[model samples]
Target: MVWKDETKEIYTEEPKEENIFKKEYGNTDDEFTYIEKTKGRDGEVKETVKVSIGKVSRYLLTKFNFKTIFGSKTDKIYFYESGMYIPKGKTKIKTEVEYLLDNKCTTHIVNEIIEKIKRKTEIDEDLFETFSENNLDLIPLKNGVYSIKEEKLLDHSEENLFTFQIPINYNPKSKCELFEKFLDEVLYPEEIEVMKEWFGFHLYRRYFIKKGIILLGEKDTGKTTLLDILIGFIGEKNKTGMALQTIAGGSDFTKLSLKDKHANIHDDLSSKDLSDGGGFKIATGGGHISAEVKFGDYVQFVPFAKQSHATNKIPPNKDVDDMAYYSRWMPFQLDNVILKPNPYLKDEIISKELSGVLNMALEKLKYLLKKNKFSYIKTDEEVKVIMERSGNPLIAFVSDVLEESENGIITKEEMYQVYSEWAKNTENLRLSKEQLGRNLEKNCKFIIAKKGTQKQGRYWNNVNLKGNYSTFLTSKKVIYLQSKDDVSLLQYNKNKSVESDVKEPEETKEEEEKIEQVKIK
Candidate 1:
């Protein structure tokens, strides 16, 4: 063999068959040659140990499936096991690698070997670009993953990175009678079907769709029980419990909690009105949300969690006319309280009926896909009424407490005073005087005009207080008017100038009937 050095060329004879054993026992110029020299008390060499760094590297590689995930700033080291790529700590990896060395080599040699092994195993991050939204049909289960759409078992791939596994296997024939009974007890028949679709949407990871479920009911109404069943179905570790108010406000930890979560369940929802719906809009609208790791930099990620909240008081929103926020909510009312609430009912349902529930969810998911939308028993008009009352305090106040006249005007100050008083009585948050004026013009088309006389301050046109609470209660000639598009100013008394053939909204009709019954009494 001939080789060129930096300064000269060297020639050497090729080894024969007799030299095969000699080549294996002795090393020539291989830098990976690991020789541990042990000395006697007299400082004389006692033994020469030959340690194969390649063997040690291979052993560590086989024992721990070390992988490097490339990042923009820094590479993350992880180990693959069960369908997850768990972050591997430097100290832990070093300790495992050291076990193979057994103190036979110097620290420098050990580190060199570890680095070489890492270089061999480290791969590009794009290689692991899997488990995307497109692959969400593959639901991870305890025994194995199953494709809900395909209705068949899927082979587990190394790219799968789900952290939690559902406890129950896919059983299409399974039936959950107890859970069905509980659903019937807590929700209307139509609502039960909506609940099925809700569960299936989460299972399918349909985060791209901008929708969420909100349940409103008083205490002991089985709201928590229903939410618990959902949490258990998704696996506790796969769900988060961030409050709706915090999420809407985009609190730092709220975004972090939602990462990798299949559902965000707020059983005890906050009663605070949602003044800021930006974060909520982004999350439910499939926009990338920023999450900051504890003591780390912020990272942008698309969250897959479906938000479900239950509250006694549905919080009012600042802007109900913003379809981006209100349209995302599918509200349902729960009134049937469990007479004798079973403490262990949730556990029983989860333990025995999860497989059945999964089957039902998949069935509904298919139906939702076919329909391209959710089928809700509660009409959109009904939901709009509930949202108006809970989302726009100004609209609710105008609808219930005020009346419009052919030629009427009320001072902005006086109207706000009356609104503030009514808000106090109704337990609604009153908007600021400035905000009230702006919203009145923008949403209600009621102009805030300056009076002809300089002394008379600005006043809203074409509307006035309905005398007093007593007069409002006794009024019978009132007629509700709204546009066909369901624009803002949900309800106000009809006048000659604003007449149309538009049918009255369901809520206004119901209120009118209630008032007629009061008059009859």
Candidate 2:
């Protein structure tokens, strides 16, 4: 073969094959680098071309006479903070783009190339994705922890911190009236506030929210609709659907569902209706939990995103009075449901109100996130009652059978018997005496100490023996036990003074570092 030039210029000496391959492909170019033309089943020629993403990757190795000119010499992918892609890298491509603008390229052509890059950046897979809402490949959500790819939503706007890539959308009207309509669907006031907080959570990742929100009630009361709207804001790919156990569990497959996820939703929890909350607590609480990937070693990461679950029934809880468990829970109730609601309501919200709702939520998050505190309205009475009822039957059982006076005493055995009888009669309320004792110690209502004497070496509530049991209340005051078991607990008793052996739960190093790193100047 002979080498020729475009302007009819020809070389007297023919180019060697090795020199041609080396110069055109590279030193390590594959022997199969030649273009192959084969007819398909339909008799169409199948052309082979090598594609290179700026020498960063060359898996396909597609060939083009253009000679990979689309690839930028800059090492970094160029996507501005405002969800727009540029043809060059952040640092190196600027001068080149400037030179092209100053020389042969028109301003319009440069902008057109930018738009093309936005549509198809022709970058490596590690650099960009094919436009999935909040796709992880494009947007990195680790605010102060992992390597991040931060982007701005608008020019000169503050950079939005994201752990997952979200698709950018807009409101045609640029207003959120349907969002208010969505909020109106929630009949309760406290639940409305909770939804707002949830909105705040999704719009901003820096708040480091501690609690997770779950909607407890029958369907059609707007739980599904509210969650669907939130999902719309995050984009479909960034959101995942997994049972609570799957998310909180150590299983490699379940843990994989969480990788680069914006939300892990537990929608149909028909089987595991009662949650011991092992994984639930982990997802909402800011801390490190060990997880393993497929065929990979175990690694630890701070749980990202607020976990949201919806159930027609209350999920049972094992950790009673646990600050770690309770503090991480943001429970709400949706009453007076309208089952079989408008099926198209979710679509309407997504198309019309999602952007506005996001706008409203961001506005609210700017204020709520200022202190990095979740100071939202407490759960309503219905929400509280539902949480208590669903949490542990023993909570109510102990309060009902056991008295709290100085002289009044209910042994662990007695309380256990009462709980057992109650559990047997109820559907999902059975627990052993040993289990009862454990839960009792965790209860924040009353004291559990050695019954009046050591011979009775067992658990007892309201054990008032002069000053014998007084030492147990070392740091906290001993509220005079009430005689009436029916008295609604007005004040929550503090935890048993920290035992030297019992280690307090500490925040993860990631969260601690993030707090320090993101501190406002």
Candidate 3:
């Protein structure tokens, strides 16, 4: 026997044609028997080999063995296994067969197919190798879409938390210019200064004073309109934009849970009755409203109302938390008096200019947010500027002047004179007493005094008369004497030397004795 190199050469031999089976195995109990196809010379059984046919191997026999035996056109084979013979008929075997083959041969065929596929695919093993080396795990899904675990998502929760610090320095020049444009072009130029002053003061307090802005006024006084304009300038849909939630009548306050990093605009607040525990309390006081909410399973206390409104009265002795919430806002009342329409309300060109200015301010705010810098306009200088620009000197000054004036009525001319005096006296040049009164009277009847006295020496002695309380002099120079005779006593400045010359005469000794006796009764 000669041997060849095991790795290089395969032994080849001429194939011999031999009968696959010569068997006559019978199962008498099953009523099935295998018929012998070939016999020895003496017609006796020489060899008994069982040939098995399966669904798959039977096709191989028909295509290969039968073609080899008869002709290429032939398509039949005879085979038998376990007392069953398969011919080209309905009785042919259809069960799966296990072929006993050499393991090395089977492995060689599979490896060849895999190698072919790999070569055709041109798989980049280096790419996967680099990824594995770097310990980077990536999952590729259909198309370009992919997802990571929620925990693995980048953290934006920290970015969402916002704490607006006080004393925001609202630019007066910019605010004034914008407001002037709005006044002159949009709605009312006269109101421009008023709006500017209002926005300036509130924003200043909000940013510097750490107060919330509250506007109270009658319907159509442009409260909501002004708010809408502000919102428009700020870009309501932007990331740093304002959020408006209009409260209808009887709506629960729990709907006010505001998202972080957003400004809330509450509109139509007056519709809610504050007499009963209603929306007004929620706006003034923060609390949880328990009601059968449409979507909630049970009544849950949700923290809603964040601002206050005069339309809603705050409950007395509200929770401390609610009061604290209410204290955050800076409230202002809009004047009901109508003035010339603001230019911003009518002139589109000026309105656009104002909007551009407001947009610039918004950009500045964005920059501040990015830098993590919190600032506000808190100086008295800034406040004065706001007051002057807002055209609301009268409103700002009225309260102070009313307290200072001898009588509430200061003449119209006197009002202007006082304003001029105040302008010179104060750093802000706010309005004076008379000016404030005149301004108040433009909208409603307010207290104003005549110049000097109309009848300085006149006296009323006998009649006790009463009417709507008109302005009265409390000075001793203007006297009202009590006399039953209807006689007017004319007297000079007697007792000028007396230390307390203006004492009323007492008719009291007997009356006082009688009052002491009332206790005995």
Candidate 4:
């Protein structure tokens, strides 16, 4: 059978053989390809087509149909013919370009296609949704691509979905706020000033200041209460352990090893079993400790031993290695103070405020860490206040007196009074005078003693034996005197000695009167 073109009556023949496979070829001179159709065994004709010239096969199809099909007005087309019995039939054809870019469609239709392509090929819808909900502006690109402009997203003037600036007072009702409030209300102005100064110093220096603050006092002193408030303010992340039971064995030295999720709060440390020696250590380099652990048949030694009675004991005298470990920490003792909770705020409210403060501090700490700042110096006054607040009465008194008095100058009477009172109040104040004197010499550079005098014939003099007393008193000089009368000539014979001594010693009355008158004149 043959088919003729509608306009030109150009004919193409169909193949007669049942197994005939006709290959359609397009223009060899142009840059487009065409389709071919064949009748299959099921009495249905299957058609296949190509229109775009990407590879060489498609390029050859364009060359055949030069003027009519491959001309400027249209792309190339191919025709397949066979001289057989089957009839040639009309076929429906489509091209890739027409389906992809339908210019006749509206922008909404194009957008639908774009969205479908994005879902099928490129951008993740979940991420897009998240960004969108967060107020992020994301643009989809060709091939289902999405992009973000860094500058636009980071612009502070407009609120963006992904960006938020936490306000300083955002959580005013947080636990940290309560802590700050408590501190402000409870501490004296001077104490607050010192604490503020300390905070500033640490903040500016970017230091990891670990203060081993111990709160000591009687049961009613609010030690535990204060700690609870402090812990709440500092937040859970900042708190590592609450009343830690033990340190784990073979722990890393770079991080804290205490068990529990809160910071240590030994409510009544004095009442605790400290005989094992477990307590706070500060100012330790690396801020950690290592110990060996042995287990099972292999007895693999772990580096850090956790809290255990065996590990807490004071090392033996000859155990230099253990002593070195113990020397790395500074311990502070605290005395508890009684405080009544404010009736206005509920416990939950106070707790929330404290937590907020702690979180803020942690955030600040993280910021400081990024900047690589750590370590700070305390002013003398601040140091004194801290020492006093820690609850060592001796340290407190010393710090207080040091702040008030002139440097290196304490009156002897004042010293005596302070010492006498301290001795009377303090238990185990058994130091001998000599030991006390030595201690004074070492720490104070002064001598302590009672008054005494030395006698020389008719002269008695007070002796100042203070170690540096002579250095200050230069005018007083020591003098030595001897008797003028010689004892060797006084006695003579045994029998006549008494009479002879009497006769020589006697003075005439007139001589005595003349001596008296001369003495009076």
For all candidates in order, the CA lDDT equals 0.66, 0.49, 0.32, 0.31
Q: What is the descending TM-score order?
A: 1, 2, 4, 3
Candidate 4 local lDDT, 94-155, one digit each (tens)? 23223433453345433433333223223221332244334322311111111233311122
Please rank every candidate by lDDT, starting with the best: 1, 2, 3, 4
Model 1: per-residue Cα lDDT over 1-521, one tens digit each = 64332224353654343322121144434333444444332334433456676776776677767777545556566776665556663444677656645565577767766576667777756444345455767787765688766787676566676545666677768998888777766665567788888988877665756788888766766788889999889888888887777887766655888877789988867767776888787778778788775555566777778989998767777775576677778987775433346688888999899999988888887887778778875555666667675555666677666666657777777777666655654556678998787776654544445565666778777765554443332211111211122211111332322333233446545544553443232
lDDT tens digits by residue: candidate 3, 1-521:
22222133433542222422234553222111123334332344543223322322434344321111122232222233222222332112222121222222244433333233223323232322233223211111111111122212122121111122111222324433443433332232223343443332322112222333545444444466566655443324311321223322333433424322123455544332223324434433334444433443233342222232332111121222244434443444443322323434423423444434433444443444344332333343433323223334343344333342232233444344444443443234555554454455542224433345564322112211112111111111222111111211111222331223234235323433332343132
TM-score per prediction, in order, is 0.66, 0.50, 0.28, 0.33
Per-residue lDDT of model 2, residues 306-326, tens digit only? 677887665655454455566
Higher-lDDT candidate of 2 and 3:
2
Q: Where does candidate 3 have its weakest 10-residue lDDT segment?
A: 138-147
Could you tell me the TM-score of candidate 3?
Answer: 0.28
Q: Local error of candidate 3 at 163, Å? A: 20
Best of the two (2, 4) by TM-score: 2
Off by over 4 Å in 4: 1-177, 188-211, 215-222, 232-262, 271-284, 287-346, 349-351, 370-445, 448-451, 454-521
Cα displacement (Å) at residue 285, model 4 = 3.8
lDDT for predicted candidate 4 compared with the true structure: 0.31
